[model samples]
Target: MKKKPKLLKKNEGLNPAAAAPKIEPIVVPINKALAIRVVLMAGLVVLKT
Candidate 1:
């Protein structure tokens, strides 16, 4: 029973480490999309002027 708890703790620690990479990829694309949208908006404003 003690060993099982230890294994669970180790898995819990690794879970976040594993999940972080997955989350980062998602965030990067979102940032890239936002950047593209900002650039497009700036271009539109400049063209209007």
Candidate 2:
């Protein structure tokens, strides 16, 4: 028995792994940044009231 997809080479391009994987930098300062974000959001909300 013959499977359908095997008949086409076009399907290989659709596989995510076949494309270049996105490499993101690991930001080590995320905790400090998150703290700053929370403080800023809190200040904004408090001042808006």
Candidate 3:
């Protein structure tokens, strides 16, 4: 007879792999860089005048 895998009922912390939350990578858009530079330049121009 084949043996079955033991079920984890009482000890939840025993499984480290399943307990961890999945992390997804967040990416920023490239166009945002240009917008930031424009805003900073406008601030500097206002400050200089």
Instruction: For residues 1-49, write the lDDT of model 2, one tens digit per residue.
Output: 3676664435655664643242123344666788899999999999999
Q: Which has the better lDDT: candidate 1, or candidate 2? A: 1
lDDT of each: 0.88, 0.63, 0.56
Model 1: residue 46 alpha-carbon error in angstroms: 0.1
Please, what are the lDDT tens digits per residue for candidate 3 over residues 1-49?
A: 2333334432434655554332212223445777799999999999999
> Which tens-of-lDDT digit does each residue in 1-49 have in candidate 1?
7799998867766899866776788989999999999999999999999
Of candidates 3 and 2, the better by TM-score: 2
Instruction: Sort all candidates by lDDT, best to worst.
Output: 1, 2, 3
Determine which window of 10 residues in candidate 1 has minimal summed lDDT: 13-22
Model 1 TM-score (2 dp): 0.58
RMSD of each: 6.0, 9.3, 11.3
Q: Regarding TM-score, does 1 or 3 come out ahead?
A: 1
